[model samples]
Target: MFTKILIANRGEIACRVIKTARRMGVKTVAVYSDADAGAMHVAMADEAYHIGGAAAAESYLCYDKIIEVCKQSGAQAVHPGYGFLSENAAFCRALAENDITFIGPPVGAIEAMGSKSEAKKIMEKADVPLVPGYHGDEQSIEFMKNEADKMGYPVILKAAAGGGGKGMRIVWKAEEIEDAYEAAKREAIKGFGDDHMLVEKYLTKPRHVEIQVFADQHDNVVYLFERDCSVQRRHQKVFEEAPAPLMQNDLRARMGKAACNAARAIGYEGAGTVEFLLDEDGSFYFMEMNTRLQVEHPVTEMITGEDLVEWQLRVAAGQTLPQKQDDLSISGHAIEVRVYAEDPDNDFLPATGTLTHLRPPQESAHVRVDTGVREGDEVSIHYDPMISKLIVWADTREGALRHLRKALNEYQVVGLTTNIEFLATLAAHPAFVNFDVDTGFIAKHENDLFPKREHITDDALALACLDVFITRDEEAQAQADWSGDPFSPWHSTSGFRMNDDNHHELYFVEGDDIITVTCHYRDEGYVMELPGGDVLVRGERDDNGDLAADLGGRRMKATVVRHGDNLEILVHGRAHALKLFDPLAAAEGQDEVSGSLTSPMPGKVVSVLVEKDQEVKEGDSLMILEAMKMEHTIFAPMDGVVADIFFNAGDQLEEGVELLKLQGE
Candidate 1:
């Protein structure tokens, strides 16, 4: 084992590698950029160093800086965790030239599988099953359209140099090819610094199943079973599970064999995942091979009881395989869901904010949360907005799903939009619970997945009122403890009625609605008259701060948190964010709506398609903004003429900053 290793990554993966290195008694050196100076990974490492600016090109992807830091910290090896320099053959080669070990596959293997186009060619020659498409050096959009015309209507154009739903576009018909080609090319150029693309015949309803393979320098390889990554949105996976639900033993063996063969074909070593698109007819085609540890590797680890990072280190240290193919077997089922600071209702656009409050589910042997962020950490727009990976395990798939849903329900995140509720709903959905899912799961069941917007129920308000009453009671008791004289009625916040009935009013704001909750003190409880009607509520908070109470003659359990200025309450697995309406404060108001088109989020203006005084109809593209490596186009809300343009292409701006102004036609 290396005495000390440098992690060439950030966020959860860096912290993940650090954890395993510490377990192995190996010291870790973390490299951070300007944005990640106080990041969790930097604080967890034994040694830390500043690399460069906040941009990935200046920091994580800067070969010279990483190399210099590794040498300075006396790190004998570098663990490039999954992204940035992970699959870069040149970086691997550079590490070799510096006499440092690259904790991944060799340069030859990376080169062979680095490009999706080249990897498909090699897989086809190696007798791996392949989908019918074009995998040649074709950059011309017209050429790509012709190839798609031949392959059929449904073809996916993927970046030749990268993956992760970046630089990828799915064209359903010939009419959509031109716009898709332009957008895909633009995204590819920005994401990978490459414009080359390869077209693949997109399967209509296929399950994305990937086989995890590990190899050692002694030519030994073993597959740690398969992960079903079928649930996705915008071509990126959201839920993944190990051993692939309903997978037959024979199919698992065959797929595992094919994956190992592909690894051996490239002389691969360390951890690699060979992805396949499992068709409806039980047939599977090769996708691309990830040449490093995956973001969802925890599912595999939970099922197989293996530490893949430790395996990567041992393999890099020239050790033999830890477990042979015959010795390896699945113990249980595991599922992983990525909790990102993104909005599921808005094309899953990444969010950036300070996590005013972050509380994930408690971890145990059955549930694990791998995260690099703590409460109050700023989720920067300079990188991915993933908050954590929640992994759960059980003896059966059903039990694992139950665990997953429960954990998701207990998870709480404030101050930013999250997909937690969406994930919880999807986890408990019948189709997913029944294991009938594919890549088109989200789109096919959009109605069920997205769901109708939930309203603030009277029951929810009752719970919130119950919480408020309980907090007041606690505060009164604390005041009694702090007062010099205990019998002072002036210091008592408790509504101690001598003869007349005691009543008070409170207000809560939810969006445009202001609900008035009137509390009438009764027998040690209060009757709250909120939105729907009056409801009797009384609750006692447990040690965990969870309230178990009787509301409106019904038993209920709830958790209410005072996060910042809002009150977040979770009841019956649903969450509601509310703000206390202050009557004494300044009156609330809203700005007048104008013909000003502003940036919805902090990002760089990619392109300005319209000039000043340009006439446009509704839905006409005005400009493109790139944030978190994804491009979002600003469209004219109504038929209008452009009055002025404020920001030019390549200018970075903050959220709500005016990009252009328009006048009604």
Candidate 2:
């Protein structure tokens, strides 16, 4: 075994490899960018080095810097840990020339499979099943459109060197093909430096299932079953599971054998994954082979009781295969959910901010958490927003599903918006529960799944109101007591009365409308029984001025205060500033206003598509903002002139920043 190894990556995967290396008594070195100086993976390594700037091109992608760190640290081998230089053939050759082992497949295999077009040709020769598509070297605009016509509408244009859904587009019509092809090419060039693309017939209902293959130096290859990565958004996997729920014994055997053949055909060594797009008719086509460990490898590990990273180390150290195909068996069902810093309601756009609160559930015998961040860490726009991967295992698929849902529900994160609610809804969906969905599931059911919630219960509304009241009451009591006047009229027992004779009127605003509510005290607290006999209680206060009560069986932290006859409350991190009406004073007047346009989140303005005095229609793109590595276009709300342009391109704006103004006639 090697005495030491250097990991040429960062984040969860880096930490993952270090853990296995540690178990095998191998010291590990970690490399980090400026953004990850205090990251979890850095703290987990035996030795660490700072590479370059926060951007990937300057830091993780710098092969020379990584190689130098390896040599200086005396690392016997270098583990690419999947993303940065994992599949770079040049990096592999450099390590070999320097007498440092590259713990991955051979350089030739990586080169053959690194490009999608080349991989398709290689797989064709290997007799691997392939989808019908165009995989040639033609890049002309007319040629691509011609190929799409032959392949029929709904063809997928994928970047030859794409991963992580960066350079991919699905065109459903001829008119959209030209624009989509150009956009995909542009993004491909920017993201991978390779503008090569391949057009394929889009699968109507595709299930993304991949086989985990392992091989040693002696040409021994074995398949560790499959993972169903059908739950996806924007062509990216959101949820993954091992031992596909509805798979048959015969299908599993055939796919496993095919996976083994695919790996052996390339003389593959170390850990690799053979991805397949399974059709509704049980036929599977080779998608592409990932030349390194997959992001969702933990699900396979959980089911097979194997440490894949440890296998990579052993294979690279001149070891033979430890087990044959039959010896490998999945003992249980395992599922993994990728928790990202994103807003699912807004087309799953990535988000960036300081993670004010991050509390991952405790890992037990059946649950595993692979994370690369801490509570106070900043999820910047410079890197991937994946916060962590939560994995759960059980003897049965249903058991695993139940456990996973419980874990997700218990997970709590604040400060930044996430996809927790969306994930929960997905887990509870009937089609998902029955394993009857595929890649097209989200697109087909997006309306039902992403609908805006209406009909909020009156109980919840009353609770919100009581929350405001308690906060104001506490504030009023504090102010009166601070004056050091025992006879302050604000502290009179009559002030706490709850009957209609002494009822208090509270005014609060929701959106563009203001609502008035009346309340009174009852029993040990205040009770506002709705017309349907639903009772809401504002319980007695504790020493900390918090209401000691439960709302819908969930304990709540709240403060209620009263200013004169008005009540205000703080609940669930929001302060409800309210207006109170005194019996002695006249009612307050209301003001009418027109609608305003404000940014939904903090981001940098990337473009101004409209100028002042321009007449626009509703939904016209007014400006573009780049935040969390994705571009969002703000649109005109109504048919009007652009009254104002708040910020120009390259300006960083906070959430709710007004980007443009519209005037009403």
Candidate 3:
């Protein structure tokens, strides 16, 4: 076994690899970019080296720099933890030339499965089930259009070198093919530096099931069951589970054999995944193969009680297979949900800010949190916005899902938006609970997940109001010697005044609406003038700093987390973000800023489609901004003429920066 190895990636995956390497009595080196100077992985490594700038192009993608670091650190091998240089065949050969072992598949295997079209052809030759589509090398608009026409409507365009949902588009009609092709090409070029694409038949209500296949240098291969990644959004897997919910033993065996065959056909070594699109009728077709560890590999690990990273290390060290196919068996059910720093209310847009509070679930024997971020860390817009992966395991699928809901509820983060609430909602939905999931699960049940709300609940609003009142009192008494008792009733309540009543009014902003609430102190309770009607509420803080409230004879418990003027209160199983409103500021900033297109997140302007005074209709594409490795087109909200263009193409922009102004006709 190698004495030391260097991880050629960052974030959770690199951290994950380091843990296993340490367990195997191997020292690990971590390479980081400027943006990750204070990253968790760098701190965890026995030795660390700086590569380059914050951008991946200047850092992780620079294989020469990584190779030089490996030589200086005396790392015997390089483990390309998924993404970055993980699947780069050239990098693998470069390491071989330098006498450093590459802890992944050989160059031949990578080249064979490097391109989607080439992989499809190889799979067909190997007698693996293949999908009906055009996987040709002719990369022209005319050729692609004709191929889509022959494939009929509802075809999917995928980048020849795409993975992780980038450079993918689905065309539902003939007229949409041209635009879809162009957009997919642009994204492909930007993401992978390859504009070549292939058209595939769009599967309806298909479940994304993938087999975890492993191989060693000794020509030994085995399949470790499967994971169902059908729960997706924007073609990205958000949730995954092991041993697909409705899979039968026969289907499992067939898929396992097919996956193994696909791996053996390419002479694959190390850890890889064979993805397939399983139809409702139990028929499956091969998708592209990922040549490294998958993001959701924890599910498979939980089911088999195996450490895949350890396996990768063992394979790279010329060790024989750890376990034969007959020795490995599924032990239980496991599920994983990706926690991202995004706003679910705002279409899951990537968010950037300081992590003021990050409290992951209390992990136990059955639950685990794989992450490389901590509280007070900055979630930069320079890379993927994934915060962590929450994995849970149980004896049964239903039990694991039930634990998933509880885990999400226990998870909490402040200072920026997240998808914790959104995940909890989906986990409890009827369709998901009943095992009726697919790639279109989110779209098919959008209404039930994000229901329109008329008003905030009375309890929630009351909690917010109380939070504001307590915060103000604490600030006022910070310097005073008001008995160090934190939960003193005297400090929280209005002083006992004979023949005098105290009334307090406060305003809070939930979203765009400002709620005005009046609190009148009574003998023991308080009368609140809410928007719905008058209600009596009583609340007090305990020594543990949790609030117990009684609103109109109903009891509820809540905890308020205050960050400056912003408050995040947890009631029941959901969390709400509210800001304390100031009447003076509201009056000064009452004018609505309309008729302008602003960048949703910090990004570079890819293209400006209009000039000053250019007329545009509603829904017209105005500009394209690339951020978080995704392109977002700013569109005209109404029929208007562009009055001003603030930024030109290739200019970096901060979030909420107005890109262009429009004057309505």
Per-candidate clashes, comma-separated: 0, 20, 0
**Highest lDDT model number:** 1
Q: Per-residue alpha-carbon lDDT of model 3 for 1-665, expressed as tens digits?
A: 99999999999999999999999999999999999999999999999999999999999999999999988999999999888899999999999999999999999999899899999999999999988999898988889888889988799999999888788999999899888888888888999889889998898889999999999989899999999999998788999999889899999999999999999999999999999999999999999899999999999999999999999999999999899999999988999999998877767789999888777889997899999999999888888889999999999988898889989988878778788888999999988999989899999999998877546677888878766666556665663445576565555547355676688788888888888898887776778898778888877777757688888888887888888778888776677777887887655545557887788888899999998989999999999888866778888999999999999999998888888889999
Off by over 4 Å in 1: 470-486, 494-501, 540-549, 553-557
Clashing residue pairs, backbone N/CA/C < 3 A, model 1: none
Off by over 4 Å in 2: 455-523, 528-548, 551-665
Q: Give one digit per residue, the lDDT tens place, for model 1 in 156-195.
A: 9888886899888999999999899889888998888887
TM-score of 2: 0.84
lDDT of each prediction vs. the true structure? Answer: 0.90, 0.81, 0.89
Ranking by lDDT: 1, 3, 2
How does candidate 1 fare on TM-score? 0.95
- Model 1 lDDT, residue 354, Cα: 89
Residues 470-574, candidate 2, lDDT per residue (tens digit)? 666666778778889856776643335444455555555444445555555554455554434535465556885556666434566555544444444434432
Better of 1 and 3 by lDDT: 1
Q: Which of the numbered candidates is closest to the native, going by highest TM-score? A: 1
Each model's TM-score?
0.95, 0.84, 0.95
